[model samples]
Target: MTASQPTPASAATLDAQDPLRHFRERFHLPPGPDGQPSVYLCGNSLGLLPKAARAAVEQEFAAWERLGVEGHFHEPSMWMHYHETLAAATARLVGARPLEVVVMNNLTTNLHLLLISFYRPTVTRYKVLMEGGAFPSDQYALESQVRLHGLAPEEAIVELVPRPGEHTLRTEDIEAKIRELGASLATIILGGVNYYTGQAFDMAAITKAGHAVGATVGFDLAHAAGNLELHLHDWDVDFACWCTYKYLNSGPGGTSGVYVHERFANRPDLPRLAGWWGHDPSERFQMKKGFRPMPGAAGWQLSNAQIFPMAIHRAALALVDEAGGMAALRRKSEQLTGYLEALLRGLNLPATMLEIITPADPAARGCQLSVLVHRNGRALFEHLAQQGIIADWREPNVIRLAPVPLYNSFQDVQRAGAAIENWVAQAE
Candidate 1:
């Protein structure tokens, strides 16, 4: 890769040829001072709301207003089984059968619950292996789970840190540790795609390696779910959890989902925190004495679900399904993100001043590029935000720019590059 003139018009041509361009109109992008739509590239943090989400939420509101408590089951939206409506679509997106999926609580909460079942620590094998720089919330959950098991947090929770002076963890390094610790590993809970570096780990390979030594494998797919193509069931993942707000475009704090493999599909007898929702739908109203887990992932549910957020997820997933699912999204994502990488490399910026930590291979990453700016990083990021090129910045350093397949375009990438160039010039 070498520096060359960034022809914005050629980038614009790429945007015009994009098949997913029409989907951008379905969103309401923020407007700038010139009253033009903003170039939103921060879909990795929170996604733009689909216009359909508005109607879906309003329908639920209207149904509640008209039917009152009757809305629970009698309303037009039929809240009784509202979650089920989104299950199949969400399942299809994650490559799981309807029975293998569950639309449940938020990400961390679900992670804790899944840990309760999967993290069965024992005398000989009782440790959770994860990436060192995992999201704070996940690390906190791991610490708490370790403490709850009556073990020292530091000993029970082992973070597979990157090699010295390296920013990203490598696949070979991870497998080496797994091979060494897999026998004594109770559960292997890793992020599907790293949140900070935008590195997508090989889920199938990771799962297979972990299972070879009798370890329960799971993933916190907050970064991978809709952003990357995943076959959770096929990978034989013990469990997985994700929020729908990022690439799924379901809005902030939108409904989350989980996957339990078909191996556990019919084992309704598995120990879990059972609520009325997990009881047999047929005998649910009977106030059953014994807990009968639903045939699949739904068996993990507890109590009533969030209907409004679930409806938004339903509308958002329809867009995902219509866009030809994760396979198609991933295809465009590779070229589109590669275009951004190409443009970034074309800049004559100094390596000492700026760095792209994301992997060059599309198979090893999603659409995110974690850019590290050595000079005035935060200010430069704020400047880009003021320019309406939405991207997320973590404290200290790192800006995650995600060119989402659904709405983001090549023009957005070019606009971002131009803004960063201007920032560099100003600093100079």
Candidate 2:
């Protein structure tokens, strides 16, 4: 039941037999300046760079140097519609039709773009429903959008708080709030996965509940898009957005994607910021003053894609697809994260002193484990970092360790757990 019994070398033997073990070789993992590998458990913050990403990006750069203007149409990967090329793979990752997805700007920017279209609010129904402790960027975006609608954020937004002493939100409480908010609800935008806690919400059920009350439902899928199983189209989610830099392994500030259901396709009435890229391919060069929005999510594009970022994103996604997409990844994620949880529980650590804020159910979360450091959380995290265990630290007491199934092995999780226990012992 415990991981401590296994010799560290046994982990290498286990990794040798792992079906997805070869994936680690595809990434150029972080190394100390001295060229030693850093124990990277921070895929939720920034993913390790895929070797293919480097190669793919280099092809584009090489083309640019040799072909100049010809790179747009003659390049191996066309920049003229670069983001379009990525749509197919992204759609598969998020469970949407290819036409329903488009790779474009960064995460926060994409969220703001989606909000402009979906967050229509009338005086009677101007409330934005969200979890109380959403990522600061999400909270800021919602508040700014509310103010743009000519209402005070305090009056226009409704945040759902967990009851006293609870770390996670209850589904029943969320549904009750939707029922109670009733007519005042304009849009429901939520994190598809809670960032700090790594909790994956029930997208289908929430979408259904929101639609029942005439609210348009959307999600910011920063943590869930690739780390968890998603069917945004099947869930009937109106729209969703996520960055590729995290679980997608596309490196920092990599291209992000947005999903607009097929129902919204060709619906010219939907508000969107415009550019030549969103214009019809042939007509884009027509230089006609009138705008002609393309069909599906491509119409939401504001500018041509970033070729290097899109190339990197494509390379990373190929790794996910090669591993048999989310189906295989999710199955392994359950086991890997479950194994980590088991190791933590075996430490016999008191729940009062340390805690896992993430949901216990595999159905409700992804591969990341968000641990609350009971005492001297920041110092403990610093100590772990010094030990070459790279996890992300949030204010207060949270340290998020995501053992990405695509590249991380059970051995990595075991070492991370051991590091945490050792750090705790040192503190004592």
Candidate 3:
């Protein structure tokens, strides 16, 4: 029920013993007024820039300067097959086969593309089931997709929400809803981790339940990709898409990744909107007539690789891989987040002041802890921001702080706690 409240010395001790402590030096941290690195805990919203990203980008710039029109093939990292280079690392990140994954367009774009292929609505099976309070972009995309199919958004989409007073959805409730929707469920798409409450859903369980109802299953891994340990293939997830900007640390508007289960990968008969890049590479340049789709998830590509962003993405993923992949990072993440929660609990603020909306069980969440600031939430958020503690505030009243395993230290978490304690004392 209680942890040994983290002290300055204890935080230092944890940092000293941390195997991934060296990783903190690999990112470019924004400095506070005193010129010290600010306590950054906003990774769930946007990750800090990796130190290697600049140099990787510069290398590509140099290739472009020298080769001009020939750079597509002559560059060292060869732009022609650049997406392929990212395939393995990305597949490893989400626990999928290389062919099942492809680094391509942004998150929402890929989601629409995947929907075009997967959301096959019929007279009987024409409804989608998703978690309520999903990210706004996902909500808009789902609505638009439904409307495009000559269906009303309200009727074609079903959203699962928590019980009256609860903050997060229960797995049993989700499965029960899926079973209830059985024959009419066309596809099930939900955030692998809910962005609002920081609740990491039971993805494998959800996938199983959706499949049992004869519904296609997919996930938006925006909050899950680099924050949680995902096994998409083993979970039998049909398809998935995620942006690289957030937990993946690939900068804002970074290239995204998509996964199509291998069973669908080899099937060209699957209906999808196509483009020249998605065509087979063999006769791709021959000015082909009919669209001969490439095998695997790459078949969904609509444009050339966004080379600049992909370069930074490569730099960021290298850090994840070097840290012994997601398994090791997740181990550190649990401890770091637990430390943050302990520090917050030790504050002993009034229940009206701050309440953690995220699931209390570590297994049900990722690195983020979404705290509901009941009163003066915005003022408190501003205070923390001015104090050089970088966290994010959501509309109405939630403050999200993510102690990223790759860069954030226990001391950073300590400073953030101290800032909160100081602010709450002054306010109350």
Q: State the lDDT of candidate 1 residue by residue for 256-316, as single tens digits.
A: 8999888887886566778899888999999859888888888888878898888888888
Candidate 1 vs 2: which has more lDDT: 1
Looking at model 3, residue 84 earns an lDDT score of: 89
Query: Pairs clashing in candidate 1?
Result: none
Q: How many residue pairs of model 2 clash at the backbone?
A: 0
Number of colliding residue pairs in each model = 0, 0, 0
Q: Which stretches of candidate 3 lie over 4 Å from their true place?
A: 1-4
TM-score, candidate 3, is 0.98
Q: Give each model a TM-score.
A: 0.96, 0.96, 0.98
Q: With candidate 1 superimposed using the best TM-score fit, by how many Å does residue 389's alpha carbon deviate from the native? A: 1.5
lDDT of each: 0.86, 0.86, 0.93
Q: Which ten residues in a row have the lowest lDDT in candidate 1?
A: 1-10
Local accuracy of candidate 3 as per-residue lDDT tens digits, 167-267: 99999999999999999999999999999999999999999999998999999999999999999999999999999999999999898999999989778
Off by over 4 Å in 2: 1-14, 32-35
Kindly indicate the candidate among 2 and 3 with the higher lDDT. 3
Q: Each candidate: RMSD to true structure? A: 2.1, 2.0, 1.5
